[model samples]
Target chain A: MGPDSSQDAQTISQVGEFGLINRVTSGRAQSPGTLLGPGDDAAVLAAPDGRVVATTDVLVEQVHFRFDWSTPHQVGRKAVAVNLSDIAAMGAVPTGLLVGLGCSPDLPTTVVDELAAGMWEEAQRVGISVVGGDMVSATSLTISVTALGDLQGREPVTRSGARPGDVVAVAGRLGWSAAGLAVLGRGFRSPVAVVGAHRVPEPPYEAGPQAAVAGATSMVDTSDGLLADLGHIAAASGVAVDVRTELVEVPQRLTEVASALGADARHWVLTGGEDQALVATFPQGRPLPEGWRPIGAVVEGEGVTVDGDAYAGPSGWEHWR
Target chain B: MGPDSSQDAQTISQVGEFGLINRVTSGRAQSPGTLLGPGDDAAVLAAPDGRVVATTDVLVEQVHFRFDWSTPHQVGRKAVAVNLSDIAAMGAVPTGLLVGLGCSPDLPTTVVDELAAGMWEEAQRVGISVVGGDMVSATSLTISVTALGDLQGREPVTRSGARPGDVVAVAGRLGWSAAGLAVLGRGFRSPVAVVGAHRVPEPPYEAGPQAAVAGATSMVDTSDGLLADLGHIAAASGVAVDVRTELVEVPQRLTEVASALGADARHWVLTGGEDQALVATFPQGRPLPEGWRPIGAVVEGEGVTVDGDAYAGPSGWEHWR
Candidate 1:
């Protein structure tokens, strides 16, 4: 998938920029929105609703991912997964992706192949395609993914749409990624699910659209802890969000791993982030969508609270910190 | 525009991530296409044509820019300018931008403000807004820009449509940016126009749509040298392109700068890249569009030649090299 290996293993500089691009992108399928894919000045995507939802994120080496801790494939998958989660948060169907990769010239060409393969694998799962992107030489490996999605004529479910009395629910596992991170940090290999979760999060892709269709008042993806991201909703919607700790069902795998490590699992559930779970507030009395579990409710006020009290222990992950 | 002066002129680590985001994006006006801007899960933009054109580029510190040579403002502007040039090459009007920034937490908070200001200033010039983006701490500064454009019901001008009987034309200044780079390398800054050209290129943006309307068969931006970029057109279209050196008019300022530096002005004109000038091929017997000057012609065969001969020079920039 990379280059002729009969000769000596080639570095990226030996392969050249265009050569690497040709190798990585060859024979990949295009999605429905891709009118014109790679190998052009720009890519064209169908935005049938006269609107396109877009988001971008940059993951730097050592900061977002470590080569010592992850394979290039996992880095690629995580980059795409987090971006797709953003689209899912908007209640839009992901259609296309543009990736910008910066890496050292001395790096092996096979690493880039693995990265592309991982990105392609995850993108295929969500019914989207990598439309276009750029690659350049840098001191470190950095990934920038720009995700485009189609609204399908639905209003974007913004974080500002929640109101008092709306029911807050979550879809997908929480704290697994955080638990995985802890496991990796401690150099423990037990609890495969937890470790795998940190490597490649399985976000509830369908839950986002399902919530929107079920009339979710507001929505968000848990990238910065459940409470912290919900705090954004509260701040934006101008209402108080009360999360019920007892009602929250902690995943058994996380609990087992937490106990093994002599830590509280509830802390992970409450403050751990990057699980990409869909947290949404639905209109009162509306039945929860498939795969959703009720965890909280909106109240009349500002800021987020737990069981009507400000229960906080390390609010969230702040990049500057 | 920045943090309070009373508190040790704090770094990003002291100001925090959210504090920086709020300071940079607060109270900025949004364009019509920006249905939702920053501070959301994702931003939504109007496409209206059922199609959207997208492109992305990543500019790494030291590799793409040097802090010693340019201000944060110039770096930000160049990042936006280069990406917008790709959109223009597609014969589409840019509608929005999504920026992803990675920087060391030790950087001063004011540097980020200047960078955002420069980005906002440039985006406003193109009649769009910075719709969405992500920022995170890294070892060094890196900027990734994703530009979205609307074709407005026009067929995209791709590089693969040139016919044998076509006249090649170019709009906007050539060699000035290259000359400016040479001037900067020599630590001389007398030629404001040339130096400024390198710092902030004023691409013939309007020429893209005008050429499309005038029935340009194929179009490309000269991010690579004219010969190298034209080689792409030739390869894509499977047609030979010939340049008439005498027909290529060199601007007086470029010639003066080249003479002063004891350099071949034609070398800069032929092989210098990053001009972002729109180079296009139109059917023979058709008058060139406004602001476009005739330079060469398309012929039956493959590859690019100058004055009926293959001119020899370093073709263009190679990122991996």
Candidate 2:
């Protein structure tokens, strides 16, 4: 056995990346779905459905999460959630994940375990499993997760599929995470709705396949706020989308954050991001599925419009800046 | 078109990881292999072959490469090299790489660009492509890369297949990179061969497939040295491996360092790691191809020995520590 072989009390940094990696992967029981997992050139996953949907997201410490504001658990959940939302955007059911982690050597070993736990928990929420991952030492903590999804024989509903006269609908909460950001930023506490919204976003993971089955012409994940994401759809599909602000049922929690921050609730609703909601365009004659609220319509022009005009305050969230 | 558009002149510490990342990945082109690529819920890639080989490695600033010691190009090449070596270890041809970079925002954009150029240069060397990557701000520069490869319809040659009668062979340079390390460590300008080895490792990309085609039963990449990697094969295959030390050749460049450091050149040859060479087991009667040199033979025992004993020195390299 390697010298630092104790199951406990040995920090990963002390052993280094390869040593810690060997310890983490040593003696793990293998599962059937894992044709070839970690320790190989690449993981060989059986995508029974021909096409596989893949997405990668990188989360850096401080920039992506503040230790002062978010628990390690929250950071891990957010990392996984953001990547899973990408899979949902593809209208695919996530199947496995390949994580590349670089953490400061001084970070507690329990932090890695906690992050993995958060990833597993959220992955389980979508009935997906975390197949394998790698850990390395760095000056800061980062989680780079690549989610693999199974399309299940369905054509992926891309953002470039919408056409004129399609009804635009959205599923899941919008602007909640951004509103929670206000509370976290202002050091506000005890608002269950606000705090809960920030810690773990409830992405409508199911709405994607539902829309796919419901014959959606185009779909996208509401990552960069509704307007910006819809604008992406409009640009990619070469059709304009007109959104009606009257249809936005702003949750009371967001309204309170708006009051507290002296900021517009519509700013969060229109431009704030990270809800991981699903938005799709359905043909006018087709009916929208349950939980999908009609908030807009695809039109002849190019670009996205709020109530038929370019009404914007703030834009959507960006990963880096 | 975001706030990070600010000329990328900020110091690493100023804007944090998020800002740095936005600056790094701002305008890189996305290849056709990418279905979703960077931003969305997840990315979708076309895996025409049913199986994919995956490997990840992390490089810390001071540990993997010192900002003061290594050029960003060297760091980038090393990052991609280690991952590519993993793919080669599994007898797979690397196709694409996904990078997760964390760096101090204050770091020069030219430095980061140099790193990317280095990655592209080495990637082209192996015929693999950089499909997608993520950048974020961090306390220092940390490079994480995940390589995807295809085995071209051949079964993966795992470490579990070395038999008693197999011959051990090596492909690519040994002790060169470690000699290069000694050059860097001693802060000496001499031993240019060693320094060159340190700056860039030349992994025999085709040697893995060649070994596979030549009927290799087991294989591994010599990142941690011939002994340590051979030990892996021995442990995994339940076979003993003995290296013929007399047959081992040490290049001329390692002599000066060995003398200055009061180290045995043999130790660097047998135990020195990070050359990214390939080692494999072939049938006793068969001859290896041009690039490979038969170093030893597999025996019935359950461990590795040099010249029929436990020849030990520094063992092998371990990251983080």
Candidate 3:
């Protein structure tokens, strides 16, 4: 059943803002790092390294996701996952989250309950909690999540540190979400693997700090596709990246799905976004970290290329373009 | 002129997401505590006190403010001010901010420029910066601001620490925003004082730490009116608060405005909200902090009272009510 089909469901307006807040925050277990949780003007968190990594991502219904395509719980998980991935890309471990939710007053409180439950589930995976947040009435459903993390005394892995003769490696799935999106777009849900991947990404959260320990020169999450995000590193570091298709593995599952859809799996692997895979450049002589596979090389130039040739078509997604 | 009346103004879609992001972020100065700024996967801020205070607030167009009554610049300032006030209420000084903006594609880029300028102006006022943010397309203008702060080694003064013998005091203006809102609702904009107060609040940022230093036992910001916020302290601290009308000062300027509009100035002072004022409970013997004035007392009871009596009207604003 759809979220709004229940005629007797309690609307958020009926419960009121304070009531909803209490329902979402009450009786929740917080992590050790959460010094002070919800029910206050602000939340206090332990920053053991004396530094904090913070990032925010906003997801609007229809613009970023669809209620018809994904459940409120899945949407909630995706929202928190995307922001936490940004924190992970910084080579930090997440400490807490603050949510800013805007939804129509007619929205069912059950939707909010499921959404908060999904957020808490994702946060618990990283040993954190939704420490604080704000809720307000709006015309549409908008979720803004801010994920905070601790650096653990390591220097931040920014996009500007890549150098020549560095090997580019990636940890986590690539193009799987795009494959899932394609299946869903074709009105098919049987391939739940790709659809689930598209619904909630499994970002390589620990690989960020692991890469930092492995002396990664630069690191970024493939939220905007591999080549496009690599373009950021190239532009910031004044270097060129060339992805070798032979070294870049296009998973057999994606290939089969692409064959059925009459699409290019290679293109999906190189340009699909939202998978939240961690891509980093490291010195050429050392072994890549476990779970990381070599995919490309950094050269003393600019822009990204596949097999040293520019790939045709749009590189990645950009809003309002 | 209205924001959309400019025929030649470029729309946000024309600039595209990256172009707009670069336009808003380029050449912005960051605070000394910002270890890493925008143009990254995440921002790294120096949390020198080994702990961080975090809060999030969401403001939607029309729901929170109207362009017909206030400029986007004013809206931006109000958004940042409200969040920073939460940090201050925790007895922490703000270090940085992250913004999540969702606007329609047809929105004028000029509006974004002005909004960002106003946000920077307010951030600069507190010696901080907008370190990172996300921008996306939505049907309405939604702004979510996440503020991070440093406690400077002092314990956070939560709302649950008030005692029976505690004195209740306040710093900064009260009922001014509600007065302004009333004036605007009546279509009379001549009194710039109250109108501007409604447009932007002047939260006493330093007064929070000052109250902590002055031995404040419990504290809260008056975002939901003086009496209503005192009710929060009362409920959380398991104590009752009585506001002595004889001791509370209703400013003369508000009186003049109230008289002109045939309204009660004292009532506005008691129940109006959005002043961003700091309210706290302190021990009975010590002198109050500078800029703080005694207004009430906490005792062994429940709920809040106005001059030892129940208030006759609504205490404060609530969303979806």
Give the lowest summed-lDDT range of ten residues in model 2 chain B: B34-43
Off by over 4 Å in 1: A1-8, B1-8
The fraction of correct interface contacts reproduced by each prediction comes to 0.87, 0.57, 0.94
Interface RMSD of each: 0.8, 3.4, 0.5
Cα lDDT for residue A216, model 3?
A: 92
lDDT of 2 by residue, B258-289 (tens): 88878677777788788899999999999797
- Model 3 residue runs over 4 Å out of place are A1-8, B1-8
Every candidate's chain B TM-score? 0.96, 0.89, 0.97
Q: Write candidate 2's Cα lDDT for A180-223 as tens digits.
A: 88888888764768677777788888888888889999888876
Across B13-35, the per-residue lDDT of candidate 3 in tens digits comes to: 98899999998899999999999
| Full-model lDDT, candidate 1 | 0.90
- Give me the runs in candidate 2 sitting further than 4 Å from their true place: A1-10, A14-19, A22-31, A49-51, A256-263, B1-42, B256-262
* Model 1's DockQ score: 0.87
1 or 2, greater by TM-score: 1
